[model samples]
Target: MGLALQGEKIARNRFTGEKIENGSFMLCDFSGADLTGTEFIGCQFYDRDSRQGGNFSRAILKDASFKSCDLSMADFRHANALGIEIRECRAQGADFRGTSFMNMITSRTWFCSAYITKSNLSYANFAKVVLEKCELWENRWHGAQVLGASFSGSDLSGGEFSGFDWRAADVTQCDLSNAELGELDLRTTDLQGVKMDSHQAAQLLERLGIAIIG
Candidate 1:
């Protein structure tokens, strides 16, 4: 048992570097809050009865992390999430449509950052988002909508991509070693500068009716 609160308004508050474990903040409003370096482990942000989740939209979440948290259907739209970490969290159906993980360098140049490893992101909506040059390994991406999105130069090794659409997004120069790349059409999807292990390469070749034998 941990701290439990429902329908709380914590907007624009600074909870930097704090750790909350096994807590519940169901249907809470955290918009415009500064959660830098804050860690939430084994927490619940979604209200199952009401089918609503905590709102973190427009929040400043730089370097903030969440591990083993129930973030299903959470609203993270337009959040500044640079260097944010979300490991092993249940974030199915979470809305990250306008989340920014990048630091703008110039008008036409920018670099992105975020660590979202080993999480369940099934049915999540990431349409038109940019996650370039980030660490996003070993996560489940089933049924994710990434239309017009770009994941270039990211480390996406060991991910489960059963229902994801490869052609819907830009995944160029990504590290895809040991990933469960379901129906990743080589001809249609651009794989420029992408990295993969020999086993994965063999699998891809097999899809094209080419067999490799020792």
Candidate 2:
């Protein structure tokens, strides 16, 4: 017996620390809903007729799994999303700020324009996924596989890029100022229109065994 939230307006509903497994939340308005410590495993948050998508703004989704759902434009601001799995979903233009996304993986999904600012994404994997034109400011991606992904026009300033192969990715027109590049082999990579200081330039040249002359 699962909780049924189908075709209902459940906005502003506070269901904190509830174990809502195998539930149907289709065509439901979860906007401004307080789902703190709620486990939404095997849940459906999509609408077939309206295509209005689900709204999860300001919801605490710590350890939540939203598998096989259409969550386009879902707002998740200031949410605790640690160890979350959003596999095989359409999550475009999702707003997620001030969230802890450590050990979260979105496999075989189409995610674009995700406004993930001020989030801790350490050990997160977005590789082989084209999540372009995203606003990523002051985020941490240490020990994450960011290669094989195209990151164009994304502000990657003050971000951590340690343990990622930069050669396999296309990072053009990106702001990489004050970012931590931990021994990345950039001998052959598309680095055009990148915003970097002299220190960064020196690091790149040093990797290629090219020393700056005084």
Candidate 3:
């Protein structure tokens, strides 16, 4: 019931500190825009009929947040999403293939940052993305494609990782405590420095058919 603008070209515009609730921005081109500190709550960015979401490719989204937004199938490829927060949103099938959350210090060194907590990232594609040292806790990663992705040193605790391929990505040094690690084969995954709770350890043991006498 808020602002509705579909298929519009709003690229390179600055929308800082604006809050839009229950709005629809389907197929809008927001490329090269600066959306710093902007909040979108309960908004619709995907057009189900046309099967396309708003084009946010290459946007500067520093400190921007989305809560309870339907960003299904949205194109967020190659966006500068540092310090961005997404909480309790439906982000299924969203494409974040080349998003940058890193601040490079040299040619071969960088530290990444972002806060994507308690959101549903089911079926979202994060292939080859570098999200090291970020806060990605309590999110649903069901069937998400993370091939060649590196989530090292990230806080991925309490996540629902059903159908996730652990061997296809590098999750070393990640905090994966209290997460539903579905079908995670330990032999194929290198979980060095990865943290897990006792329950999760037991679950992994049980999955490997190891009987616990105690």
Clash count of each predicted structure: 0, 0, 0
Q: Worst lDDT window (10 residues) for model 1?
A: 8-17
Candidate order (lDDT): 1, 3, 2
Is candidate 1 or 2 superior in TM-score? Answer: 1
Give the alpha carbon lDDT tens digit for every residue of 112-210 in model 1: 889999999999999999999899999999999899999999999999999899999999999999999999988899999999999998999999999
Residues 1-214, candidate 2: write the lDDT tens digits: 6777776666554566676666777767665566645656556565667665566655556555554454555555555555455544444445554444433346654334344454455544555545455666666666555556677767778877776577766788888888887765666677789888889888889878999876
**Which lDDT tens digits does candidate 3 get at residues 76-189?**
899999888888888899999999988889999878889999999999999999999899999999999999999999999999999999999999999999999988888899
Against the true structure, what is each candidate's TM-score? 0.96, 0.48, 0.94
Clashing pairs in 1: none
Better of 1 and 3 by lDDT: 1
* Number of clashing residue pairs, candidate 3: 0
lDDT, each prediction: 0.93, 0.62, 0.90
CA lDDT, candidate 1, residue 14: 46
lDDT for model 3 comes to: 0.90
**Best candidate, lDDT:** 1
Best by the TM-score measure: 1
